[model samples]
Target: MTGTDTDAAALFASARERLVDAPRERLGDLQEGRRFLGIPRAARIVPRGTAWHLGVLLLTDDAVLATGDIVRSRAEVRRGFAAESQRRRAELAAAAARGGVPEGATVHLGWHPIDLSALDAASRPLALREGDALVRWSAAGGWMPLARYLDERVELLRHPPERA
Candidate 1:
């Protein structure tokens, strides 16, 4: 969405080579300490608690990527956002099942898209327009919506300003 020149096709190809067939050590470095890292096609969200957290969110701005697991395109970004919203709807149901989001509880959900052109090419934290923060990230897995997981905390990380 930002004005930048990134060859999506080349970026995609590079991502595939580095991530789709990466070795474990390379994957570890990316996950543990770098903005860009290689990951395998088998990436997934490992359940850590009663709820779900995409292990890759740590390195990403948002929690969904179009690695071979899902179609990647402007359409996919839109669809992924929809899917993430739906996932939150499901989480809401789950929370309601468990007595619902507390009157004053909070959770943090994160995701990242590898091809976003607005982020800094230098691999550091970048600011999204409306005071939102952006970061580079990649990992093996599908996406997740955690609004219910965040409850009222969603205000803390406001979504990027709506387009004109």
Candidate 2:
């Protein structure tokens, strides 16, 4: 995530403060490929303000305190983008398999560029992955590289969620 130096610090600080007193038991240690996702729910916290949607948790082997709101928003955006990208990929793959080039001999995956300039300090802690969701660290004092976290979480979901 891009942000001014001061803004980034503030965002990091808020996340740390929120987790400071949280129970260690509540803050479980995720196994390799496991994530601690919250329920798929939405809330209208204010009478006039926009409602916020929650995202799935992607627990990691490493300990980090991820908030529900940030995860939900990132997951929703990633899901939308990933769907569009997959659709285009499939269309191009089918065209190629049929032994013909697309109309312009071009295959494109829709890509979006996010504007980080408008993000204030508190939300600037998150990072958007190229093919995955945006994520932020739970701790202000310790930081982990996001790529490793994503790789581990993806492996855990390989078997798919159990059916109720």
Candidate 3:
């Protein structure tokens, strides 16, 4: 195989080894609720603000694929009949029924592929850019290589810092 092909295969293998699966109950919720083309090769659920963001990675035969950010807001009661709030409530209910989400959390599953052009102004700074590699673990932490990002993220999820 060519050098590039070999490198890609190595990267894919590394990612596969480092990847951690999301909670089993949430897999179907993520697939059907988020409308993913198929089950992600690997996924990680990390807390973001009062929400949880599911970071997904899919290593396909031809390319390394990822979703933009699958966010689910923390559960809370809304007093108004605002359309958005109503929609969120319904989404939360569906996700809860499927055991994909915790109580009261609202799911926002958009089909956005992670790419340079696809990133908006707000998301650009957070994404790491190395030639063709661009990825983000959270809203903070600036930019970093994909492999480093995965390693650090996996470690963080496994051993979160104790809150002061």
> Which candidate tops TM-score?
3
- Cα TM-score per model: 0.20, 0.22, 0.42
**Model 1 global lDDT (CA atoms, 0 to 1):** 0.28
**Candidate 1 residue pairs in clash (backbone atoms < 3 Å):** 19-39, 43-140, 61-111, 62-110, 62-111, 62-112, 63-110, 63-111, 63-112
Candidate 3 per-residue lDDT over residues 1-164, each given as its tens digit: 44433443465556555443422112122433343587543222332222122245433223344434344544334456668867655554544435435754443333233343333344343242333344554466455555565566555544557981
lDDT per residue (tens digit) for residues 1-164 in model 1: 43332333233333333333221110110111223366433222222112122223221222223212211111112224367766544443333223322322322223234434544433232223333334222433322222221322222223323670
lDDT of each: 0.28, 0.30, 0.42
Better of 1 and 2 by TM-score: 2
Report how far off residue 65 is in candidate 1 (Å): 6.9
Segments in model 1 whose C-alpha atoms lie over 4 Å from true places:
1-4, 23-111, 120-164
Candidate 3, poorest ten consecutive residues by summed lDDT: 43-52
Candidate 3 or 1, higher TM-score = 3
Write the residue-wise lDDT of candidate 2 on 1-164 in tens digits: 34353343344344334334332211111112223385432321111111111112322222222333211101112224357766544433443323222232222112112233433334333443342324444545333333443444443333335781
Ranking by TM-score: 3, 2, 1
Clash pairs, candidate 3, are 75-104
